[model samples]
Structures are given as C-alpha cells and as structure tokens.
Target: MRLSTILRGGIVVACTAFASGTALAEDLAFTLKNATGVAVTEFYLSPSNVNNWEENLLGNDTLSAGDSIQVTVADGRATCVYDIKTVFKDGSNVDDRAINLCELGSYTVHE
Candidate 1:
C-alpha cells in the first residue's frame, strides 16, 4: 500500500510541475507595426488594470511609416490583457485597452 501511495504521489508532483512549466513557457511576444501615414514617435504598453503607464518601449528610436518592431511582453506582474498606447509624429495619440498579449501575434497602427 505504501509503495502504491508513493507512486501516485510522484505522478501528482510530476503533473503539477509540468503544468507550471508550461504556463511559464507560454511567454507573450508579438510585433508592432506602424501602418499609419506618419512616423510613430512613442510606444507604451501596460497592464490593462493599471493606471500608471510604463516607459516607452521604443526608447530613442522611432518607427517610421510602414515599419515594424518586435515586442516581447515580459512584465513580471503583468496579466494577459494589456493596454497599448501609440503617439505619432504629429502629436496625435491612441490608447487601446484590453488587448490580450498572449493571443496577439501582431498589431498594426493606422491613421
């Protein structure tokens, strides 16, 4: 009986470990494209539930029209849903919310 119990316990532990590993491995990554007529001057991504916006993901670089950039979502405390903000060279901006980064492979900005 003890041997059988040990075997069942091992199986449970293995299954739990595998489940957690799979969740961690499912990291989110995608591409952001500037399809608008003007250049994109800024980009920001934040958790959908948060009020404070994070830093500019683009840093010092600008995304010109028809260009694209890869974005890897790695926020330690982030959820699957995110908010995307983009600013254009003309100072126009867009703020979109409830985007599922886990399921999104690409996002395009248009005028």
Candidate 2:
C-alpha cells in the first residue's frame, strides 16, 4: 500500500524516509544513521541488478549528520538486495552495491 506523504517539523517526509505505523512481512525496514559528517540531501535505492536508481526518498527533506531515521523499502518486489545511493549537501554522492535489506536492521552512512 502506498502511504501518504508526511510532514513533520516543517519537513516533507516520504514513505521511504520513514516507516508507516504498520509494516508488511515482506517490507524491509531499517534505521538509517547519518555519520558522514555532512547533511544527506537525498537517498535512492533500486534492486541490486537494476541499472537505474529509484527516486529520492527524502523528498524535500535532509538527514543531518549524527541523525537517524527509520526507512522502509516497499516497492512490491520480492527482492531483498538493493543498490544504495546517497547524495550529500555538498553535491558529492556515494554508491553502494548489493545491500541485503532484509537481513540488515540498520545502515550507517559514513566517511
């Protein structure tokens, strides 16, 4: 099910940036910690085998350094592994491959 966008403290948070009240058994929910010492301006995920990254999960929001947010990936796909991409406020970005979301309860973006 698609969740409605949420606004908290004046920031627009999309479903991928935060978990809904309930979770599906197939959904992958995990805590995203920002440890890169820079604000994260966007987050994107696509199945590991996919060539293109999905849309930004943050919408108009940003994840500041040392902050954490619960993120949920519910794209209706059976796959559990994904390629992660995060863009920082300074325009630099990081790309990671083959992250098994179902087995990962938490992910930290650092360095």
Highest TM-score among the candidates is held by which one? 2
Q: Superposing every Cα of model 1 onto the true structure, what RMSD results?
A: 14.7
lDDT of 1 by residue, 1-111 (tens): 001100000112347557777433334567777888898887887778879787877766678888777666554443678888999989999988888867768888876
Q: After best superposition, candidate 2 residue 48: deviation in angstroms? A: 0.7
Q: How high is the lDDT of residue 97 in model 2?
A: 93
C-alpha local distance difference test of each model: 0.69, 0.74
Stretches of candidate 1 exceeding 4 Å from the true structure = 1-26
Alpha carbon lDDT at 86, candidate 1: 92
What TM-score would candidate 2 get against the native?
0.75
User: Candidate 2, which segments miss by more than 4 Å at Cα?
Assistant: 1-25
Residue 89 C-alpha lDDT in model 1: 86
Q: Output the worst ten-in-a-row residue range by lDDT, candidate 2.
A: 1-10
